[model samples]
Structure formats: C-alpha cells, structure tokens
Target: MFSLYVFHLTPIQTKNPYPTKELDFYSILWSVLFVKLLIYFLAFITY
Candidate 1:
C-alpha cells in the first residue's frame, strides 16, 4: 500500500509531456483517499 502510494506520487511522462508539479500531488492524494475509503467500507461490512 505504501509502495502504491509512492508509485502514484512519482512523476510520469504523459503523451502531451506537459509537466506540472500538482499532478503528482493530486495522484498521491487520490490514492490515499481511495485506500482510506476502501478500509472504511471493509470495516463497515465486518461490523
């Protein structure tokens, strides 16, 4: 999970190649939120 978070934070070359610092940050944020929601869903089900 940590690796996945790091992976999303890493920069990648897009087709347009228009570099932007915010892209990586947003990706990491989305990844974290996704994991958090998944965990919450699982806990809800178990409870």
Candidate 2:
C-alpha cells in the first residue's frame, strides 16, 4: 500500500528532478506530504 503511493509520487518527483527552483520543490514536497497525510487520515477513519 505504501509502496504504491511512493510509486505514484515518483513520477511527479521525477518531473522536477532538481531543486534548482526552491519554490517549486517546496510546493511539490508540501503537496506530497498533504496527500500522504490525507491518505493516512482516511485510512485511520476507515479503520
């Protein structure tokens, strides 16, 4: 399950592939964290 989520995020990470643009990298990191947190929240509720 976690592996699948990481797999899905790999493409988005690869798209940027560099930290030359700080804002873009931070935004992407935030988005990924948000998504992972959301997923965990949903799973916790369901469980």
* Best candidate according to TM-score: 1
Provide the global lDDT of candidate 2 against the true structure: 0.72
Q: For model 1, how does the per-residue alpha-carbon lDDT over 1-47 read when each residue is reduced to its tens digit?
A: 56765564554434324446666666666777878978997899999
Q: Candidate 1: global Cα-lDDT?
A: 0.65
lDDT against the true structure, per candidate, is 0.65, 0.72
TM-score of each: 0.58, 0.57
Predicted structure 2, TM vs. truth: 0.57
lDDT at residue 30 of model 1 (Cα atoms): 75
